[model samples]
Target: MLTAPVRTMILMVRHAEVHNPKDIVYGRLPGFGLSPRGEIQAERVARFLSARNADVIYTSPLLRARQTASVIAGQSNTATVRRSKSLIEVLTGYQGSPNSILVGGFSFYTPVKREGDESMDDVLRRMTNFLSLVIKRHAGEEVIAVSHADPIAILRLGLEGKPLTVENLHSVVYPERVSINQIVLGPDHVPQLTYFDVVRSMETAA
Candidate 1:
């Protein structure tokens, strides 16, 4: 239980590298896990989180996200992981295309807006709501939400007061990059960015 003036924080984590040998956009279709090196990346992230205090973790139902959450939470206490639909990947009608959404990003979304896919605004709304709820619930505690690139990126951009366009989405957070976006919520429930850092991995350095 938190005492007076509880502090709340949440770490937004993008899932590690995925098994995309076929080079197709995975979207929310299913059946994708982390690559071998991606597992290493996950391990590094886990180690990184192990050095901090993560009271609870929330993950998208996607396997890659769940796996990443499991690895990180595994470094700490047990059974504190929960799945939230709001943390799922960007809804896309372009899952099976040879070109990934990262390549064209928001441009591909133009053709599928009427196909019932979620727009950038939709993702921002869902992610922001989810984040607010978690912060309020876990006041005075630290949490990690293992999510897809788009959702995490959208939330970061939204926090920074930027448009949720796909411009530079890939550059903001690379696939399986060891970056973490942290938001510290003040008592008024306003989130302040502590840091949006890309942790350099040993593989990337050497």
Candidate 2:
């Protein structure tokens, strides 16, 4: 007898903008939180998630991600907000450099992979592992995960069978600040990108 597919719904969100007036690359750096505009963005996304009826929310240990998750939990009525290191930001060697340095590297034929920086493959592994556990735990429930830009892009690209290259990562339209990337996984564990919504200045993010 054919069994029904075990569908798992996940809303993968990128945390809102940081309060980085200096415009430096804050990779795995502490003391950075959401800016005023970012708070607004998070609020909009949170209100949007309010109607999603998500069961739980998993966020990165970073302050910005946690803040976003907190807002979502309060607004969406999602009771549980768990912090997962797997959702943390990508480890980059250029943490203290100007943001332009990293952004410019993307357009290069092969982006500079610093010696101490975390490999994209490693990122994919940890992210996928966390997702596996969530899928098993939640089963049929809808959930949310608030993470950073690089990690989020890497996970989505890895799941979608796209190349994990700097060019590809840069070319792919990333989930903007406080945006949602709706994904659905079937029993086969293959994820499908159902929708990508950017929370604009609208009263409601939906």
Candidate 3:
């Protein structure tokens, strides 16, 4: 029998690279799955989390994030994989555009907010709300959440007491495709970031 602990452990993982051959912005678009290399990255993460005895996994409904969560669920001790809209990618108006638009700061610099866009505050609220429910429902259990970079970064910023702004969002070193952020919540239900690192493949001794 597994015993619960005094604090809950949450692993926030960014989904692996997508199979976007055209290099276009796929913001919240359907049908974008993981690339071949991304599959390898997911496997590496699975091994890492399996070692930690992760109890369950919650993932964004997007294909890429769901695919990554599937790999982890299969390899880890995780009993179930649940879908949560709170972990979905940020809603952007740049979907289907060239990736350069985002890289060039054109999107963020735009003076007017688009109809379907999600502000930093929106992201923070949903992420924190999801977190509160998770902490209440699974206190002291190890859990994994597979999501996109912006949502994970925003959540991290809020938890770390940083300003939730686009400037900080871009400036913060978001988790890589093969990385995970570890957040620990104690009896008081306060989230604290312990570490975030790339899940490099395990090394073997010669």
Candidate 4:
């Protein structure tokens, strides 16, 4: 049992590198796994989190994210990682096209077109709703959320009440391997970022 006001700590992490040779913006593209380097980075992230006391683990429904979460879970001996649709990467309007949306712009209103896709606003709303549910369900608990870059960035911006503009979106950079963002729940039940982009340092034994 726990007493006193408890703060829910959420560590939002970007998934490791993907297996995209041309690096064609494979937003929400299926059948893409992590590269070898990505696997190594995932292992590093796992090692970093294995020492912490995480109560729950949440991951995006994407393969890259699921693979990364699995690595961490294996290291921490945690079973049953939860999958959520809200954590999926941003749904770009253009799919299988070379002309993609520019990175680091935060314009959720700008409508891009893929054959069949949702708008940026729609994606943001769904992500926000999903985050709210997660926070309510896991209040005062330390959890790990492994998601893609765009969704993670959007979620953080939404929590801060910032407009999902292109500039603001472009400002978010995916941290190096095993970087952690510590979000502490305040008394008002709002999640605040205490630490952002703290990359775990390599161990140097004496």
Q: Which scores greater on TM-score, model 1 or model 4?
A: 1
> Can you give the lDDT of residue 153 in candidate 1?
77
Give candidate 2 regions above 4 Å deviation.
1-5, 107-114, 188-190, 201-206
lDDT of 4 by residue, 14-63 (tens): 88878887657677788678999889888987877888888778898999
172: Cα error in model 2, Å: 1.7
Candidate 1 colliding pairs:
7-140
For 83-199, candidate 3 gives per-residue lDDT tens digits of 999999888777788887665455432443477588778888999888887777888788899998888888888887888766787777778885888888875535667555555
Alpha-carbon lDDT, every model: 0.76, 0.80, 0.80, 0.70
Which stretches of candidate 1 lie above 4 Å from their native place? 1-5, 100-106, 168-176, 188-190, 194-206
TM-score, candidate number 4: 0.81
lDDT sort, best first: 3, 2, 1, 4
TM per candidate:
0.85, 0.88, 0.89, 0.81
Model 1 per-residue lDDT tens digits across residues 105-187: 44645566447888878888999888767756777788898888768877777777766665755455433454678877665
Clashes of each: 1, 0, 0, 11
Alpha-carbon runs more than 4 Å astray in model 4: 1-5, 99-109, 173-178, 194-200, 203-206
State the weakest 10-residue window (summed lDDT) of model 3: 197-206
